[model samples]
Target: MTSTLGFAILAVLARGDRTGYDLATAMRRPIGYFWTAGHSQIHAELQKLRSADLVGFESEHGPGPQGRKVYHLTDAGMRALRDWVTEPPRERPERDELVLKTYASWLAEPDLIREMFADQLAAHEARLAEYEHHEASFDEPPAFGDPRFGNYATLRCGLSYERHRADWCRWMLAQLGRSGERPIGR
Candidate 1:
């Protein structure tokens, strides 16, 4: 995660001071969950950021407990983030496993394909439910330009994606002559 992806972790640190665990937890929110790095990856990237003077941390020592490091963005980190934001992004190849499998589905057993798509549909539904639960915490009709608006907007992205994925999986099942739609779980 040392390259541009590492910058994603840096962007999170820009928010405020966080321990490695806190950083990982922040990532589990809509933005981080969508483009993910595990806790170890976050820790590794933090070390790199520290080495480059982009981020700094203070160690809190206790009498009988292990020390904890709380990380914050250095001025260099802010400059780098500002610079990176203006850089044009490189386009990467699409590598979705489901799409790849669909391309070769004719060669596989029909029943297996049906089962796989069914499982995928169910997963998307579950994710949608989780996102909906998170959405409940927002103000009813969140105000424009508010901080919570950004959070709600990202949550909407996740919700839209899960809904589309679930619908696509059902469509695929129908195309394969299998019934796929299940009762929508609230």
Candidate 2:
């Protein structure tokens, strides 16, 4: 079966053909914001898609990509991508390290936990600021069917998620300060 990464490769190809290097650049930008895959992982997935008959490629003839493959979606790949687009996404298991830390935080000093959350909040805020700048750069959202529409929509979601995370961190900080939270003795 084609993996989710395979579909990601196909999705990129749907926009247009690209060499592995170009695809890596695209992945690092908007897609990397969500679905992260390393350069090697993307290449491996491309090979898998080729084996599955989901993608095709021509010999690349660019500077970096000299003699490399410029991959493109096959008809079957397009059909599979369209079908996957509408189907509900599978639920990924929640494995956030900070959330896990939060679960066991009572075992650590409250101040240390506060520091961690503070750092997290700052990171989230920084990303939020960048996303905001990007959103402002767009004169308007792309109309549906534009590939840019996908980028805009995902940025909006990232905005919401960052705000929510920052708010939660603030709440945690407040609780840490009040009532003089004490860590449980080991």
RMSD vs true structure, all candidates: 6.0, 1.7
lDDT of each: 0.81, 0.88
lDDT of 1 by residue, 143-177 (tens): 87664665677788888999999999999988877
Question: Between which residue pairs do clashes occur in model 2?
Answer: none
For model 1, state the Cα shift of residue 81 in Å.
Answer: 1.5
Which candidate should be chosen as best, given lDDT against the real structure?
2
- In model 1, where do residues sit more than 4 Å from their true spots? 62-64, 140-147, 178-186
Clashes of each: 0, 0
Compute the lDDT for candidate 1: 0.81
Task: Give me the candidate number with maximum TM-score.
Answer: 2
What tens-digit string does per-residue lDDT give for candidate 2 at 32-70? 667889999999898889988999999856666447788
Decoy 2 TM-score against native: 0.93
